[model samples]
Target: MNKQIALHPDLDDDLLDVMEPDNGGSVSDELSRNLRALWSTFYRNRLLIAAIVGVFMLIGLGVTMLMTPKYRATTSIQIDQQSTNVLGNTDQNSVDPAAAWQDADRFLQTQVDVLQSRAMAITVMQDLNLNANDDFIHQMGGKPADRPAGPLSLADTKREQILNVLSDGLRVDLPRNSRVADISFTSPDPRLAARVANAFAADFMIFNMKRKFGSSTYARNFLESQLSDTRSKLEQSERALLDYARSAQLLDVSGGIASSTDGSTTGTPRSLTTSNLVQINDAYAQAQAARVQAQQHWEQAAATPPMQLQEVLTNPAVMQLAQLKAQAQAAYQQDLQRHKPDYPQMQQAAAHIAELDRQLNSLATSIRGSIKEQYATALKQEQALSGQVNGLKSSTQNEQSRSVEYNILKRAVDTNRTMYDSLLQRYAEVSAQAGVAANNISQVDVADTPDKPVSPKPLINLALAMILGMMAAAGFVLLRDKFDDSVRTPEDVNSKLGLTFLNSTPMLDQEMTPDEALSDPRSALSEAYSALRTSIELSHKGGAPRTLAVTSTRQSEGKSTSAFAIARNFAKIGRSVVLIDGDLRKPSLHRLANVPNGRGFSNLLARMGSIDEAIQPTETPNLSLISAGPLPPNPAELLSGARLPELINELAERFDVVVIDAPPVLGLADTVLIGSTTEATLFVVEANGSHHGHAKTAVRRLTGNGITIIGALLTKYDARKIGYGYGYGYNYTYSYSYGQPDAPSSSRKWPWSKK
Candidate 1:
């Protein structure tokens, strides 16, 4: 009987809602809600959360105790502008407010750096002999032997620590738009802190004055040297100019003008002398003629001889003839000396000589033809020389006229130098006065003996420690919440698997027997079960659902307990209920019901036994129990067989309600097999025991297989532990109000007592 029982139509919407409805609240309201939620979560996991907080607090307190107590002292200094002299009058050279403000900012920042600087720290340390005395270090748990051999280097890490201390203890702030700066310091010892602060101010003032005076002195010296150099150069330039003017006779150039005026009429008119001009012209003409001759000579020397004619004349044939002629001439001379006129050899030489003479004559004619070309070139050179000499004669007359203009310009340059020397003398006197004015910066205030020492730690640090502690605790809580995977709110159940949250049964610290839960309905625990019943009824949407299957994802998650509690709750309300132990493999309802465990559901199924024979009544009226008779070889096959649905239908007809306690959904198919017979299924999750994913997985498995998940029931609740109103006291009140013999009268008419 694989009945497809829809849990409800519209399964996607939130059906079992437990979250408070929004009231259109402000941001404060949301914050309040969030705070409440956090409180609830912490309350639920109070022990674990307390353990975490206790551990951290212990660490913090231990550290605080172990740490050496550091003393801090502070001193304040009021900076007065009147203490120092203003360089110039505000009226004469007023400081720009913007620029002065910028200077003030820079000055304050520089002062801060100076106070924290190694140079300043070293000075204080050395003055106090802090390096030799290790009291401060030892108080901080550092040993004298542990100290570094050299001075501590202000590296990034050390500087950060120093800066942190400075930032914590020392303060130098200027009042808004005011010239005064207030300086303060805090140290472990009050007097020392005050003294150190005052010392810092004193040292800074001294440093400032020294720096200014030193700079001024350097500047004054440099300027004096420049002024002296300028004066000397000016004097030298003026003297040189004056001497040049005097030597050049430029002192009375006006007298020269008068002479020129007198000479203009009295002196004979100085025209160019005619003889001198003619002589100059003649020289120029002679020089031009020489230049032309030289040019022509050079051109003639550079000309090449005719190549073809020269080669022909120097030919081998012509040379041979010449040689013959020479031989004939020699033979004639020899013949004259010895056998001149009558030798046959001489007659033959004479005949050859005649032939050689004829050839030499022809060669001489060719040479004559080449010499004729040179004669024409020589004639042109001679004619060009005559014209150049004439042009030189005209150029000499022009040079004689420009000599008078050159004399007048030379005299004017000398006069300007004499005037320059007079101005140089006056400039030197003014420069010396300016150089004297440059030396300024004298000390206005000196340091007084400091009254105290400063530093170790301060009160501000204690306050900061507390603040940091709180923040660390809060951060841990937030991070833990973010990573936790357990089911926290009912909204988680609804949202994860689209299952209705039948009830959010508040947590319980200790276990309660079934008899105790039923006898006192007004108890907190009983009220929670009552709420579970009401929620289940509402979830039905119409007729009350019979044949409810109780299951969970894993074993020992209180599924059986929740089934028993819910059945007892129903039976207490006078409804006829049949509690069946549907989990054939491991049944525990027989123990809870105090009924015999033999011949239960599995036995009934195997033998075709009547439901009446198998069912047994519990001590509570209207409550009947059927335990798992025996362990089945195969629970799934037995539950899924035809006999199971027949048994479920038969029980439903006889009893107003049938509560089937099914096995875990994930590990076995028995729950899913039995689910087809049940009208609705209820998932039971143990508070803080079952993971959110496990519960969701169970719901998903049931719903995914088309089983009707009615809703969920949270079991083993610790209402007192979770800050809910429940416990043994509430149970005692319920028992007494419900007419038990030993009941207290006060519990009977309590305001929270149910009808």
Candidate 2:
């Protein structure tokens, strides 16, 4: 007798497809769904997010207003890699560019470190007398020092305190490939900040100059010490040379000895004996030559060849004597040719010739005698010079033996003198450079007082506050959404439980009972159930199932109400529908239908009543009810018998649609047993009421027991409590005016109504 409701031609096929159970989808689809859900969640909690953001903004504004302002001052100074060479040394300029840049980088970094060093800080503080300035110390957040205690005196403690303050307020920065450094100081007072910054820069330059000057002074002092030692060594060496020469009797004929370029002595001074030997030897040579000439002249005369001697031939007196002799001979030869010796005329010429012959003999004899004498004198002088040379040669040879030690001492003296000269020259150079103040570090710009403070910016604080507030609000909403697992919409039905979504019933007003809402044809609850009925009717291939059971996981979740509404809707549609209260533990169908519960399905299952006696007519034209007769001690045993299925079969034969109002399925076997006897079961879930796990467990239990589950119906759904963006329409009420057409209004609206 079960009749299948035919599909309406006006029903939307696409809507039915959307309401069907969803299989798995692509990653993009899931992601888009999640995004939609997140947006819906955020939209619903827009008020909470705004309130949180406003509070954070207020806090940021308050903090920005109350914070103390600080002033910052900076001083720029240039720090060269090497000091300026006033002497213009080319060695520094000859450095490779890469190496020089590297060295300059290292030097610049070192200067930055020095600028921020504690020692430099102390120096700056001393220059400013900040240690003693209590007012400045207090402004810089340092307390005035107490009396001396423990190991530190008052002055020492105060200096340490001020040093700490100076260090904390100081900052130094050096840029890449740059020699310039920026020194900064921060304080509450602009003047103080500027003063500290300038003081740091100025003192750094002074410190560098002092370091260079100190190095110069050290060099000069070292050179002076070396010079003094060298002077003593030179004097000692000279004295030793003189003493050695005197002790060995090695007199220097040449006053001073010669020195080689390497600072070593070539030899000792020349000895007197050696000098004398050289001079006498030269004289001996000259004398020997003269003696030989004289000897040749004398020998020539003695051997009757005196005229052949060069000297004799060149002698003027000898030449005159020879010419007179030659004339006398000629005259005598002429007289002899005429007459014998003693003729009167020839006697006069002969007498002249005789006179000339006698004169020539006498002159020639005198000249020969003189030449002999000269030769003898020259020989004696040569003998004398030779003897003197031989004596000096022996003395010079002896003096040479003593000159070795003398030469060593001379070399020592030379070395000492050379070193002393070098030291003296270097000392002079250093002294000259000592007064030349060539500092590579110089102040580029002095720090000036800042006109504005550098802190407590309102706009920046508000912006930060806004960002933080948004993050906090987003985190809170996401966490709220994550922890909430209640089934709220058709999407929740598919995503949470993977079940087909039939329809959602709007929560009815407390003033209107389930029976009253079902009595109205235009009620939202009635429309929801009607949609659900259509979904179930089409869920079957042969239209609606012959018998259907309505159940939930928990009590008071509108399971009985949904069951009553479904049956009433079917009856209103002219189908013979029988609603049975299948909850042996707690039956609510009789109450929902305003009927007595004296006898019901439990009595018939217990074999205490007949099916015709158990069935009762309802106020609806085609609806009837089978209420639970009485509370049974063992409802599970009664429902587990074969009588339940037979009773369901009998009800299916009697009515076109059989609806079972089953109990909750979680903690009992009564609904599962009742559902297994029916054609299919409708799972009822309360929105924001039944937990997802409990509903899934209830569904699994019913399905595990071989009970057919058609779909799920969400009851008591409030769109405002849950999010509204599932393609579900906005919250609207069914506005029905008295005596108006039964058509639902399309224009009437209310802020607080639900659809």
Candidate 3:
């Protein structure tokens, strides 16, 4: 017998899958298995998916109903290819109309930008009186926010926010390849929307007119200022000229620099008196030039040496005589040094030198007289020029005196006349332009009241809601499936529990008992149990397992029914089977079979009754059952007794198969004690009831007690639901054949095949 040990189901994490996967199985088999597991997950979570989708759809419907509606109004304005300037042509460099036409789209975009500007929006708001409109103010936001401490006052801050609200409703669009632009605004009231859009178009035209005629206003003011300054300057010049003429006791000239009457002047010709004075000035200037030349020559004669003079230096005779004298003197000096001073040669040389010297002195005297005569001649010429200059100056004294004040008055009056004439002309042009009353931009169309609102589209919202709901549903299902630790699929239990899948029993009717299922041998339930019996018989090497114990992680996992069904099926096949209710703590065998629980395992273990009285007959053919006898005070103590194993062996001797329905291994040691005594253990796992941790812990509990597990029985299995295979036919019962010749040829080999 296996050693009796103590362990709890939830106390270990290392007890799972001790047996590693075999290096066997084809890829096709693995694929089919994974697909089946996925199908099972979807099937189980279908309701959750539906609930999520329905809830989301309702929410979408609610939002669509409660949402506010708005009306949009658009006004069209024509953009001409070339803009006309209503202002007068005062600007020197105006834009070429041909170039402006080429960039019409750019200009159109500029208008669009202007339409969308905050400045435009503020104007529209003021025009609509939106600040004082209760509906408008309430719709934007009832009260202004507490003003931040900054440069702006509270009213200014509020105005900024109102401008933003207005801008949000404004939109401007330029139609593709067209010369027209649209100005649109949205509002809760259809009439209001139309009114606001029309107002914007009208205001844009007004603003454009102001822009075009702006130069006219500037020109009028500029001309007025210039006219005033000129009038003052003209008066000042006239007054000054008159004051000077009176102070000098002189006659008034016929004309000034410019002729004027009534102190008003224009740029015109001068009078005869002025012309005569000009002629006199010309003569005086000529005379002064002549006198300056004579003076310059006189000074040169007096200050310079006669030899340096042009007249003296240019004399050829003087230059040649001087050269000969120098040579003769040199010759005399050389002879005197060679011989006595009384020698004839020396006397001749001296006599030649004396003659040359006397000739040089005569020439020098002549050059001096020539210089003096030239000086007197230059002095007389300069005085004559000076006397003419003084005579001209004296003769024009009256005219010259009048001319000084006259020129000053004339220049001032001429400048004032020119400036006044030009300014007056500009003022006239500006006034004419200002009266033209035309602007380049003109409104082409006005907005009409809209009949339909542009928001709260119910159908679209519902469709989007449906799509979102389905996505949310799928996400939640996958999330739950991923985090779930329970074993819901056959592959999950087989892979994680490290156990052989003997057979899967379809879920039987809740109203029917296991003994009742045994009545119909050809039923799906019977066939499933039959397959399970065959698996247990072939699992052992020598022969069929004589004693098989069935148990699960916790209570109500259908272990008792599954074990009884297997035993009942065995008995139906002509094998003598005895079912023992080994779960003394919470036994359901007596109730399931409608048999009395008096004098069963607890009575027998306490030695209160004989084994013959403990055993009872069930309605199942060739099948006998023993109830849990009575609720024992301590089931673990009674199961651990040395007589328990001997009694199990005695039952095995009497029957070909002994099926023991052991207590759950989660919180008690009853299953472990029973499993150690049995020939083989069948871990009964409910389809969705057993968790990975619980099953693993239970398996470890039995294995730790040295009990060998024969295989796992997946009870209450739903075939059609999991999509593995349906019907009690070839696929569900025999889907293990994936072209492997040595395969078990049935679903039994799918989870437990070694090679």
Candidate 4:
């Protein structure tokens, strides 16, 4: 038998005050609620979670122990941006720091790629003779080449296999803002790893040098070919120039100047013919001036009388003869005055005057003759100069026409000469440096034998395993919570179904009966209902509802039990409470009350009996029960009438609280009809039993019909299932058995559960 406590007639104001925060629905409160829910989920499944993490950790340890350790050896090499110039030619203006840095970065990246190339790997293999070295092959996890029927085919297959292994083991890395590249190789043996790394570095340098040599050799050959062609062209052009100059008779004088007839030099000319023409032209101009002066003198001498001629007048001999004639005339005039006609002295003087006059005439005529001779000579000289000038003009025109072809051939010769010189210089440079290879790559650090393996670290693997296991556990829990939309707690009642959460009623122990637990006011079930009563009282300003109907989404969800408990708790508060079984299809209040079903709610609504006849007294004081009198053929049609409302009004007048146990909401309209007659309806949800969709749909149906829902009562709540009361502030396991503190509790136990 369960222990019973003294019933209190007053409601618990403190419990009602404790529920005020839930109504506030603040953001912080919601966040805390959610966080607590998550923690509770983890707490409930802590053992399973620990087992999963431990299993993963064990797996990690096993794998770490079973795996083969790999040793890595790294060799560092420096890559220069600009290689050394062996030709001693450097362009200062071509250097740009930014451009050079960019080029260096690209070059380093290319070198890294080259280090990882298959060809480089082949060269390293050949240098190390790795395919032929059995120990190295075995260390790299390869088999020795087998001598098959075809040796060539077998050798090729072996080479391919080795290359694959080498490629897999090789790694080259060059970081940004750095010129050094690290070439690393991983192997089971540290010595083999180091040897292969060093071999790669050495062979890479040799390969770079070989490439440089090949480039220089190719350059030399190309220059040589070009030089030969240019030399031939230069020779051909020179020959053509010489042949044209000779055939056209075009001569080039030493200074392009010639001497004139007057002992003066002329201006420089284009060729020998031009020089001759220039000298003759100057002579012709001088001759023209001389001819003009001589002709003027001759015209004066011919137009004037012989004695009036300036040359004749200015001549010394003519002047002397004139003086003598004047003297003789004076003497003859003196003598004529002395002697009469034929005096001997006068005759001698006259004869002297005549002879003197005749001499003057001879001198004048001689002067005239000399003027004509000078004019004739000047005219002849001018004509001769004009003829020479005309002949030279024709020669110059002919020479100019020949000079065009000469100039063409001269340009070809000059061009070919320039190209030949350039090709010769280039060929010489390439030949000189063909054997000198300037390698930009140099070894920075040779790889050494590794002291320890780089893989299969126990601590890191275990840590990673633990982290992955935790993530997987979280994902699983979230997935379960997402798909499991069951009403398991008061929180679910409020959150999932969007109903007011009144209180949570703990499930009764399997050994105890619902009647026995309800009879004891000290039991968890009793305290829960009392809380439910207080929550309901706080819900409305007027106090607890006068007429309340209890219903659930489905049957066996403890609706009838909750109705009985609510009524009994209300009666303890000194209120006259009536419990009515409103399920016309199936009545359970009669069974719970242990009363005979003679007449009840259905009979009262059917007008077959009075309210006094249908109403029956329960064992608990201040409490009444009304059983479903008889199963109606059509419960929905029977409850939809006006008689059900009249019966509820009669019960309300007699009892302070009317608790009706109605049928389920789904697949039936009887609950909605019965609930409409009451002031409010209590939605009873089975924890971990009722589906959220069904409960929501049932509540929607009730509300759609204008039936007021007071709140939800979470029945059959298992505290362990949802982490101990879900922070509802009510301990579901606590019992008020004042004398028995150490009584054995009834709860499930697992292997890892605490005491």
Ranking of all candidate structures by their TM-score, best first: 3, 2, 4, 1
Would you estimate the TM-scores of all the predictions?
A: 0.49, 0.54, 0.56, 0.52
Residue pairs that clash (backbone atoms under 3 angstroms), model 4: none
User: Mind giving the per-residue lDDT tens digits that candidate 4 earns over 1-755?
Assistant: 01222232112222343445546656986787678778767766677778888988998899999988999999998887656545443653232233455466666777788888999989988888877846666887667777643646876877877888899999988887788889899998999899999999999987887775534367877887888888888888878877777788877673322346695543322577887888989999999999999999898778889999888888999988898888878777777877965877777777788888888998899889999999999999999999999999998998887777777766676678778988898776676576343677899999999999998788999999999888888777777777777887556776788887777776665677788878776666777777677678878659888899999999999999999988988998799998888888888888888999988777877889887887798898999888999887887888888898887897788789988899999999888888888889989889888764888889899999999998888777666656744234224433333344565545422211223
lDDT at 91, model 1: 57
Candidate 3 lDDT, 1-755, residue by residue in tens: 01100111111111122223355657996786667676667777778778888899899999988877788898988866555444436662243254555676787788888888888888888888876634665564345646743788876776777787678888888887986778888877788889888988988877776665545376688788887888787777767766665565544444434446666554333444445556656655665566566567656766776556665556788678768878877776776678987898888887887887677567655776665666566556656655655665565565554555556665766677677788778777776577443555767878999999876778899989989998898888888877776765556666778787766666655665556655655444565666566666656767668998898888877888787787877887788988888888788877777788877888877888787888888887798888887787888888889988888888888899998898888988788888888889889888777754788888887888899999887777665555444422243233223233564435342221112
Could you list the CA RMSD of all candidates, in the order they appear? 32.7, 44.6, 35.6, 41.7
Point out where model 4 deviates above 4 Å: 1-28, 41-123, 130-184, 188-466, 724-755
Better of 3 and 4 by lDDT: 4
lDDT of each: 0.59, 0.77, 0.70, 0.78
Q: Is candidate 2 or candidate 4 better by lDDT?
A: 4
Clashing pairs counted in every model = 20, 2, 3, 0
lDDT ranking from best candidate downward: 4, 2, 3, 1
- Any idea how many clashes model 2 has? 2
lDDT of 2 by residue, 1-755 (tens): 11211222113222355445546666997797677677778887799899888888999999998987788899999876655456434655433233365466677777888888999988988788776657777887556878865699988887888888888888898877677888989988889999999999988887887665434468888998898898998888888888888889888756547545696447857677777887888899999999999898777768875445556567787778778878777877876887987788778877776787667566666767788899999999999998898888888888888888988888888788889999899987776576444777888988999989887788999999989998999999889877767777667776777777777777766677767776776566665677678778777769889899998989988888888888887898899999888888877778777899888777798899788898899888999998988988999998889888888887788889998888898889888778877888899888878664787788778878888888888788766555663234332242223234665456543222444
Best by TM-score: 3
Residue-wise C-alpha lDDT for candidate 1, range 536-568, written one tens digit per residue: 776785755888998987898778877888888
lDDT-better candidate, 1 vs 2: 2
